[model samples]
Structures are given as structure tokens and as C-alpha cells.
Target: MTMHLALSALLAIVLAWAGLLNLAAPAFVRAEFEKWGYPPALRVLVGLMELCAAVLLLWPNGQRLGALIGGLVLLGVVASLLRTREWLRLEYPLVLLAAVALVALV
Candidate 1:
């Protein structure tokens, strides 16, 4: 149980930091996110969603719903990441998997 909580905490931290990075450094993943011809607005929206989700994810009863949101966020990235195999691969998907796992176990 504790381990699940700990893992959730770690996942939350990762997402929170990722949100910060994306919001602060849109260029970091701009090209990758744009690969599907998505607009810059999309990238901005994803960052905002992630930032909000991270906060929601930290609260006790919010975990499950948070995971759902986080999963949506990752699913978007992973779909694209799979196509590119990513220049900065694994980190996003791995954290996403962790979020999913936390949802399952918690």
C-alpha cells in the first residue's frame, strides 16, 4: 500500500515537473508534438492540462480521475511517440505507465 502511494507520489512529481518544463520550455517538445500537424495551441493546451492534472493527482480521492486525465495526456504523447520512437523517448511513456499502474493498484 505504501509502495503504491510512494509510486503515485513519484508519478505525480514527474508529471508536475513535466508540466513545469512544458509550460516553461515549449520548444523542448515542440517539433515532436507538431509532427501530426497539430497547432501550437494544442501544445499549450496539453501543458495546461498536465499542470492542472498534477495538482488534482496529489489529492487522495482525486487519484483515479487524475490517472484518467494523465492517461489521456500520455496517450496523446505515446501515440505520437510511437510514430517517432522519440528523440527524447521513454521518459514520457514510462511515467505514463507508472500513472496507469498507480491507478490500477491504488
Candidate 2:
């Protein structure tokens, strides 16, 4: 249980940081999104969804839902990176998705 909580906290923090970057319209995020052919406006929506998922991770009852949301978000990210042949960038989302699955299963 302690390990589960720790992983959840870590995932939440990472998601929050990434979400904030998306919301802030950082140059790198904008450039990456543009390169991936995603609309700039979609960044804000994804960011908000990620923030919600992070919040959901704080409670036992919400953990599964949080993991589900996080997994879906990472799935999209992985798909996008794959589509662009950005194999190197695939590590982050794949790792995050695995973490989310761990939390969901445990």
C-alpha cells in the first residue's frame, strides 16, 4: 500500500508538471504539438484533463479512474509519437502508461 501510494504521488506530480507546461504554451510544447500536427488549442484541453486525473490519484476510490485517465492520455501520446516516428520520445509515455497500469492493477 505504501509503495502504491508513492508511485501514485510520483505519477501525479509528473502529470501535473507536464499538464502545466501544456497549459502555459511553452515553446517546446507548442513546437512539439505543431510538429505532431495537433492543434495548439487542444493542448489546453489535454492539460486540463491531465490535471483532473492527477487530482483523482489522491484518493483510494479514485485511483483506478485516475489510472484509466492517465493511461488513455499516455496512449494518445504514444500513438502520436509513433505516428511521427519519434521512437526516442516513446519512452516517457510508455513508462508512464506502465506506471498507471501498475497503480490500476495494485
Candidate 3:
């Protein structure tokens, strides 16, 4: 595969695997997210949302929705990071934005 394809593949696996992990073990990840100041409900919501996004991402026609959801996720993360005064963490959102852009471009 070309580098771009490889990257997409890796991203796909990461997202898909995360979706499964979230759905299968929300409480476990929720604990980690709680340390980051997110509530259990928020963690579960994020996990469920991620699971949906992952399904959308895997669907050929659902790319648009996935990208949109991903962008929104990035925005939400950025907002939280900003509120926490963690400008250094901006890269995470930027990366997600880049992922959305890349997926759209593809």
C-alpha cells in the first residue's frame, strides 16, 4: 500500500479497535477519562459517539458523516483542553482535524 493508504489503514484500525474497546469496557476507559476531568456519563457518551463514528467511517457513503463527527469531536476536545489551560494538547485536535481533512480529501 502507498503511505497514505497505510496511514488510513492504521487510522481505521485504531478507530475500530477503540470503538470496540469503548463499547466493551466503558468503565475502564471512563476511569482514565475521569482523571482528565471528564465525568463517567461524558466518558460513556464519548465512547458511544466514537462507536457510531467508527461505524460511519467504515461505511463508504458515511465518510461525510464520520468526517463531520470527527471534526466535532476535535472541536469538543480542543474546547476542553483550552478550558483546562492546556494549550500544549492542541495538537490532539489539530491531528483530528487533519484526519478529517485527509479522509475528506481521499
Q: Estimate TM-scores for all models.
A: 0.78, 0.95, 0.69
Best by TM-score: 2
lDDT to native, each model = 0.73, 0.90, 0.68
lDDT pick, better of 1 and 2: 2
Maximum-lDDT candidate? 2
For model 1, the local distance difference test gives 0.73
TM-score-best of 1 and 3: 1
lDDT for position 101 in model 1: 58
**Candidate 3 lDDT (Cα, whole model)?**
0.68
Per-residue CA lDDT of model 2 for 1-106, tens digit only, reads: 6999999999999888878988998798899889988898888888987888898888789999988988888998999989989899888899899999999999
Model 2 TM: 0.95
**Cα TM-score of candidate 1:** 0.78
The residue-by-residue lDDT of candidate 3 on 1-106, one tens digit each, is 5654454545556566665675566566766566578766665676667667666766678876766776676677778777878888798668867877688677
Per-residue lDDT of candidate 1, residues 31-67 (tens digit): 6656767787787788887877777667878877777
Number of the candidate with higher lDDT, 2 or 3: 2
Task: List residue ranges in candidate 3 displaced over 4 A.
Answer: 1-9, 17-38
